[model samples]
Target: MLRAPGVYRPRADTRLLVEAIREAALPRGAHVLDVGTGTGVLAVAAARSGAAEVTAVDVSRRAVLTAYLNTRMRRLPVRVERGDVQDPSETRQFDVILSNPPYVPSEQPRPPERGGARSWDAGSDGRAVLDPLCVRSARLLAPRGTLLIVHSALCGVERTLTRLRRSGLKASVVARRAERFGPVLRARAGLLEARGIIEPGQRHEQLVVIRGDRPEPLEGPEACGDGT
Candidate 1:
């Protein structure tokens, strides 16, 4: 797959999310959406897994192009767009939503709007991207749909779950892996220690994949109806 230097490369986190996708066991012909699709890896995976429609969105021009070209070359039917996931092209809902957005904590005050860092540097608390995703993404799912997201546990897994649940989805950590600090985090270890995000000398952090499921609508006797 072609990728610009500024695009997020498919790595362990991406592969882990893919595993979770397969485990999701989406129904045939399910519509899927991949937010922050750097190379459209999840988008392609969804198409290969029998998604009826695939739509991918990213804020970077290079990322948008990288995803578009990758899916195009594979002859997959994917609609790659450039924008926020909140403002997708249409009002359609998806049966499955996937994301591996910027979650690495950084000293940067705000998330970057461009460059490769945009794929990982999420901000001082690492919730700049996560916060919005947790708060707004549940509405994009169809009834009984699922949303899968992966990020470093340092960013606050509980907070993600709380936000998703508050948005009406049942959320929980579905997968986790302990990984040594990568180059970025290693470089920021001092900052992490100073902020008490990690213990002084901690060298590893947990990566987690969280799944949020939207319940089917109430029906029959349990459903609220107009007072008779």
Candidate 2:
């Protein structure tokens, strides 16, 4: 059953995350972190993919409980926790971190049908969760590790990339899908911009999967030039 705020239900996007992580070709036995482990979909996938250890976290206690149950059902090796993405105690460090954060920007009052906390909302621009996730990722990811984020293109992909770069991480677009919001799409960016969240002239509807890799000095320009 799908949950409120568009998170509870399992969707194709979750499967996409699993496929993308597998495509990255991470070594077996590597420690993995599944941020916002929602229904433990990615966590279970990682465990099945041969991760040595998988730690899953969600800010919602209910989600955490759900993840734990799901992990038990699959009999996967996963440690589930309840905490915010920015919490330092979430874990020491990880070899791989994956997250499908709440991607909708909060441009206006949430609908009566919507319960704010059940969904990922970052003020007027939807970066509330993502911005902090990026910062924490910089600290949590091990050297040469990878962090994958799936988000809607309507939220400002370029700006997301820029933030990742400023956070001492290299960001790039990994995947995208074109979706229509019809007449509602026209006012999306404006609603956010009116609140000074988005700058003028930003277009919506372009979900993307972004990848950020931990830096390795040996792989730097000097090493590349050394050619040895």
Candidate 3:
């Protein structure tokens, strides 16, 4: 139950991510961070999954408030903070990081600074937020930490995997689901088709959850290697 007008509502993508989280086999008392948390759905789910410390961050103030309120109402110990994943200020690392960020491609070169559009509109190629998040994941995760991010396949799932891997994390697609176009995507169907981002008459998009894991540190000689 979100009271904020601009906060994104939990939909198919959210449900998919939650299901993946439940199947992640998170260790008890694991620390989790939810980026772009709207209404704290994923954060609450993390708590229910036995995460000892759950923190949620979002760029929108209203979204932060809504998430905090929802978590409180559910009696979940989730700390909701207002922050942007693209330019995060928090320095704490976590065992798991979760996100269902804006992935919709828009005509504008960049997302809106305010209003409802901020919740779903990504840049022209839909990599505005996704790219940055992938780059930062390695730094945000603790040893053997995992990152689970959900987005439309139209936004380039392969690109995400490549980026995360280049950042020194093992990445792969763990889950996927095809969903019919919603009001937002439906309205941009023609433009997306024109841009060759979608089929001429495509009415659905595949949502994928990419999982990236930071490898555990090597011990003994590997840890104290000479310059090689």
Provide TM-scores for the models: 0.92, 0.78, 0.93
Best-performing candidate as measured by lDDT = 3
Query: 167 in model 1: Cα distance from truth in Å?
Result: 0.6
Whose lDDT is higher: candidate 2's or candidate 3's? 3
lDDT of 1 by residue, 67-168 (tens): 999999999979999889755344778899999999988888898866788889999999998887865567677888889999999999898987787677
* Full ranking by TM-score: 3, 1, 2
lDDT tens per residue, model 3, 1-228: 766887898999999999999999887899999999988899999999999989999988999999999999988878888887656565788999999989999999998898988888999999888888887767778888999999999999999988787776788999999999999999999999999999899999999999998888722222342111
Which rank order by lDDT, best down to worst?
Answer: 3, 1, 2
Minimum summed lDDT over a 10-residue window in model 1 is located at 219-228
lDDT of candidates 1 onward, in order: 0.85, 0.71, 0.88
TM-score, candidate 1, is 0.92
| Model 2 per-residue lDDT at 165 | 67
**Which stretch of 10 consecutive residues in model 3 shows the poorest summed lDDT?**
219-228
On TM-score, the leading prediction is: 3
lDDT by residue (199-219, candidate 2, tens digit) is 577554556788988786423
